[model samples]
Target: MVTLPIEFRTPLTEGDVGALGVLERDGIRFEIDSGRLILIAPRTLWHADACHRVANLRPYAYGRQGMRISRTTVRCPDVMVLFAEPDPDASCHDPADVAIVVEVVSPDTAVEDRVVKPRIYAGAGIPEYWIVDRHPTDPRDASVEHFKLGVSGAYQRIGQAALSELEKTG
Candidate 1:
């Protein structure tokens, strides 16, 4: 992990290219909460593969794309499936334009992936959210949890499927 700069501790506004540079330079993941930047763990190979698999499913789906959840928060989801083609000139897509968001969980990010992101994504009115539990120890043990936003603006656990099963059919 690259050393986090001291400046990142402060709150930032939208479209901060410098913060985006920090992400690129450090090779660390970031999630902005109320303009307060938070660190995400380095992704494992399994996590990356899961992202690729999800991205490959749809032509409009992309991996590691920045998204604006609110005016003050910018998050880069592991995989994003958009309803329509993204604007080429925009730095990040608005939450309303995203059809689904996928997070591939690592050991250090399990709680954030399973708990924090679901609430945030659901509140943003994203239709679907997927959490991929990529088992590092046992590839066969990996599974994905599917959540769908309910009318009350919360995510409800809908289904789960093993990664092995998906590979067989994918």
Candidate 2:
């Protein structure tokens, strides 16, 4: 819950237009926006573990590195699978090379995780996006929701399953 102070500013936008600041503390990540220095919330152990499990199960290279989807959109997804080998020196992965983006929801970022992030990913033309919710209304269990980008720069939910079901089968 403690974040080390760090000023991470990117000059991606036109002339003197300050963009983003990233901070990580205690395995949790945060982003500062509009000079407000708000916490972007860190991931829980359960969420982090889920990210690792997904990356390990994949047949390709993946990581929790920062992804710069657009000039105004920078995110560090829980897990990201790249289309090619990752550049070891790169600060952020190119959205075009990214295959999948997975976000595990926590209480602090529920709204952004479920709504805002999806819109940004879809706008960037990410092929697939996954939302793993630790709390769900039905059955009182975690659930995973899968979304595929539609032609109109929007996401279409394709499938969903409970975490318990996934564990039993996998």
Candidate 3:
């Protein structure tokens, strides 16, 4: 049987640094947070699709796999969309430029996505975030939980919506 390569991290930078130059290097997937590097592995289809939909946005889509942002480097849902005109000086690491962020949940990542990520995204003022639940017993239906940043610095659940709704909105 073929085995997948295990995901791992290599030290690159220090502190809450923002730019990570090692991602383009050979063999590792890196997410650059402020200054630290979190190594990740390539994502699955469900995760990539979630990011793609956000990128093929009406105005213009830019989907970046395993890009770093703020102090947390997220995999898969790392894609961001810009609905308006593009900024010449726009950087993927910039928190304000992101229209939406998506995260796919697995048993290992559920806690981080549910508890930690929201705080990070909210703190960055990321506007919108979608959490895709891929649990086995939760029905094969592709349901996504949406969240919008509230004034209180917490992600307010926009409730769960079918993938169809996302298609329509897009």
Relative to the true structure, candidate 1 reaches a TM of 0.83
Off by over 4 Å in 2: 1-22, 25-28, 32-38, 61-63, 135-142, 163-170
TM-score of each: 0.83, 0.72, 0.68
Worst 10 residues of 1 by lDDT: 1-10
Ranking by lDDT: 1, 2, 3
Tens digits of per-residue lDDT for model 2, 1-170 = 44334334543321112222223424445432322333455556777677766666454546557666545445667778787776677657778988888887877788988888888778778899988876456534567898999887888999998766776776
> lDDT of each model, Cα atoms only?
0.79, 0.66, 0.60
CA lDDT of 136 in candidate 2? Answer: 56
Best prediction by lDDT: 1
Better of 1 and 3 by lDDT: 1
> Candidate 3: global Cα-lDDT?
0.60
Best candidate per TM-score, number? Answer: 1
C-alpha root-mean-square deviation, candidate 3: 5.9
lDDT of 3 by residue, 1-170 (tens): 22223233444333322234334344445554543445666777766665565455445456553324533454334555554666655444456666777776765677978888787778777888878775334444356788899889888987887665667886
